[model samples]
Target: MIEACQVNRSTFFQCLNGKRLPKESFFEHLLRTLQLSPGEESKLRKLYHIAQIGESVYQNRQCAKKCLETLAALSGNLIPQIYRLDGVAQLTANWASLEGDNRVFQELCHLVQAEMFLPEPKIDLFVPQEDSRFIEYLKVLYRNSGEKNVRLRQLVQFPQGRGKKTRESMEFFDSILFFLASDCMGYEAHYYYSEVDFADTVGVLYPYSVITSTGVLLMNEAMDRALFSAAPAILETCRTQFEDVLCKTKQFHTPFKGYQQTVDFTLENWEGTTMGYQYFATPCFSAYLTRELVDKYCPAGMEERFDHYFQSIMAGVFYVSFCSEAGLMDFARNGLMNEFPERLVPPLELEDRKTVLETMLYRPPENSRLYLMDPEKTTVSDEFVFSLAKGKRIMTYRKRLPKLRMFCFQEQNLMDAFEDFFESLPESSYVLPRSEVERVLRQAIRCCEEQMTFDLSNQIG
Candidate 1:
């Protein structure tokens, strides 16, 4: 097989033995040599990437994968339980004995669980950095808290301010996507740009703490030693400290519950908002929506609100959107606006689709980009829509729910991470490039025209 691929056997063996990562050429050669099926080849490629990048990357990847999957099917039964983070008891015991490295984390988790039982429960967290597993776990805890209303106000410090880069910070930014992406009302974060210069900085005793109803767990810069106490004076002091710090921080994100809130926020922040990249299951229907069509088809009570929302998008801005090929084809076939309520708004006519496509093909809006991602190549669910504005906000909407819910995030690090994530998506023929977008739209227009002609002929007949 090595001779067939004309590769060195020693290098191949080394890669197999986990002593070295396989080169891209060797990996592709091996795939071809085995004549693996497309599915198997895709799996091998993912495995190869994981091997090349190390487990830290995969750890975050798995968190995203799990979060996306959970969010896609989010409903009555599939909702994550308001549960305890496993090993809290053990970790508490370890902490009591001063035995384990993760005792602080476990104790923190236990406090969160205890707070769930209290009326009007609140948690204040001062996080200096991101821990992937812990963040994912906290998301579950907060998300599942639901009606219990366990509000968590987290004050995060970005390492970027210090001009130092690390994998943990990157993962933290990645986790912030779902942290703000969901419908969870309890989770709120405020972030400040600062380096932890505790020696020079006065009055900040510990850099991290989890303040709960049960107790306040304070950890120093290293997180090795902690002071946990339930005394009212101590708790009040910590709470005051947190509030003082929070006053100096900017809000990370905000939630827009329904149509009015979403529209108001969008319109308020519309000016100078450059869309970094948007991922939707279907082509953005709102962008091309006409006022006439909006008036004609908008649901009885929602006409004014719907018109304002559509107008905001049509107002013009620099933006790029990523959509699915299947979704584009679906739009071409049915002209349905999947992002909005299906029952409320009627689908566009064939002529309308034609105009939209022609406008896209010939006089494509300046500073606007449209690309179609191969649905199979992308991990995003059809139910989810993620929109990012450069250094401004990240807005995500889920269509499956009854109402129009959107999470608008203004956190700088989150905006940065999402911008990086979107820009980093591999552009290929499948994930159509911006340059080739006109060609694809032209094809869709032709399809629309062909269908129109067929309908016309049938009507005449």
Candidate 2:
């Protein structure tokens, strides 16, 4: 490969092994030699650019930190900038005036074309309901592509309880049914009922380009005045936020037949198993909520309803989790303590009881398989816990948050990646049988009493 690219073997090896950055020309030549497809070439070019920046920043700690901050600002630009309207009209006019000269629009067009080639590419749209031209363009692209590798998630806002005709007029219902029936493309549509007044924004995200309202044009509102970006970080941020909204928002299912069933099935079997349960665990203000606290926190006139519905749901979940932990404690006392009684140390003087319990709860189990992924990082969330009770597999992906991407059976490669990710989590635990429940409880009570006695003795001394 080095000879073919007309580069020295040592230099090629250095670049290949990340010992050094190759010249831009050499890198392009290497890509050509590898016969990379257009999409792969684009990805490699972006990666190369990032690598160049990374190499420069690696030399200086302050510069690296500043670079990261700048990157974060760029990624989060979508959030703060979306609300700003100052000079939006002038900017839109200027952008629209560019017409054919707009490189970003051209790039979007190229991306729309490239998406046809991707196997199960995701396309997320948050567009105005009246924009027929853009919708038509998408339909044409999908029809002509003749490829089934597409998952489209669209978010549209509607007037509460009176948007049936509006939706039908826009062919929104028709499009959803068409895509759902399509053997190749998976479809999901969310309808946001605006309870409060807010500025309208339109966005469309594909694997390559993210297009959003730039506040640039006044004349044509049909995505003509929107800003487009191919920057990976920005696209990723947009995609992530879009998925967040989709998951939390209500779906437009009234006019669309079988819509609810489709969504329910998708979420239920999302991880490809009915038995597995995934929990994104974060620190709650308090694990156990008192009646007084619930009354204080919950709104008046809604306290009873909330307690009956939402509170009950959460209480059941907390109860199950508490019971699970208690069972583990029992197993520790009866099974673990019997085997390794010397390992248990009494709490030291002035040591907090809470601290001791936490330590005991987090201690690594013996006679079990252990696998650790990377250390917990990222402030987004605490942990992603996946438990397969039937399979006796429990894994916790610490310091990682779930991405806004959709996974289907057809996207086997992506599914495999998820499987590997779940398998890589550090923590695992097994379920104890119902027959052992009584014994587990008894052991747990004894352990608690022993700890109380030890702490009382230490205080007396």
Candidate 3:
């Protein structure tokens, strides 16, 4: 082949042995002489570029790792190709274009089917729940593969309130259950209802490989590009983020029979479990607890029914009391006071209220110790009194809750900083013993009752 290409055998051998690098011109000429196909030639060119980068960065560990990642990605059997289109109308056209490029579709199908053949296969997805077509595609893929063992982990946005788009969001949740019920696929879905919305990127992680895209490929809202990689570092990073989000979000279970039926199921199975409950004054929190309390306690008897109803009504009031004078009072007054006066008549901050709520909710086992860090005068409510009477643990700080600049568990420095901030709080901030809590709560409630006169008959009515 070298002779035919008019190249010296020694020079050709040197290039082949990696002792020398070949110019693009020489590489093209070599491909031509070997009569390589267009696809093979494209792969070779990509490989060459990767090789050049690898050689330049060989001495720098970090740079070398990156180079190696690029090389591995280019060399993989499934390299994602970018398809540019004008708008949503072009999605069908672009998909038709992909029909001619069976390699991409086939690779995706192979990954989906891997769950059936490979032992303990896992797939992770980071995506927007509003994309129904993507969910449909997954359903079709799972149905076609007939694989029952594939474990799917997804990170999806669950909007915080029943706003204009709430119906659409609820439909998406229903669709998830529909997909799950269609097959015996082992799957877990995490709902991220945070203040920060992640970039519209979809990532899929398999046991041996990873594939990521700019947006839902089945939809036409965002970029139509993807990246496929077998690089360990890249895969690990994707896996880590998927896991971090999983750790920070709530696990959503399938509502098989119906929404109300599922509620009944949860109450039956989860009643009396010591849950570390965190309350924040959000429509989502109010809606969720109302259903939970009603479902769990209303079914027991008339007395239990009234208790749960009263707790549900007071939950919001309790949250407002905690927020008052901590900087959230104005927000509560302006946004929620009128509509929820029965609940928010007591009125509320620190940093953004959402951030405080998310931080409090996401910080697990530690959340069992309720943090009452409102730097203002201690305000107690019926709910607070009831919680203390029920022996719930509490923690208090003289200072308000600190704003977390960053909350990435993977970054050791950030984790260390978080720990330092938490540990630095004065030990005196810890709440007194349970007996003290009962005493304080009782006195506060008595004071409140005396200050706010009410007809005793009205409560019975």
Query: Could you say which candidate leads in TM-score?
Result: 1
lDDT for each residue of candidate 1 in 79-136, tens digit (9 for 90 to 100) = 4444445563532331242234477667667777677668778888875563544566
Query: Clashing residue pairs, candidate 2?
Result: 91-216, 92-216, 92-217, 93-216, 120-149, 148-184
Report the alpha-carbon TM-score of model 2 versus the true structure. 0.29
Worst 10 residues of 2 by lDDT: 337-346
- Which candidate would rank higher by TM-score, 1 or 2? 1
Which candidate number maximizes lDDT?
1
Higher-lDDT candidate among 2 and 3? 2
As for lDDT, the candidate ahead, 1 or 2, is 1
lDDT of 3 at 393: 25
Model 3's TM-score against the true structure: 0.30
**lDDT at position 254, candidate 2:** 22
lDDT of 2 by residue, 1-461 (tens): 88877889899999889999999789878988999899999888867866875532222322222322232222221222111112222221323332332433443444455565666566776655565544555655665545465666677665543333233322444344333333343556676555332343334222122333222111123344445444456556776777787787765432212333322332223132322323222112122333554454444454554456333323332211212333245333433211101222221222232332333334312212212111122111112222222222222211111111121222122123233333423222222344444454345545666767786999999
Show how many residue pairs clash in every candidate, following the order shown: 0, 6, 6
The CA lDDT at 195 in model 3 is 36
Q: List the candidates' TM-scores in order.
A: 0.67, 0.29, 0.30
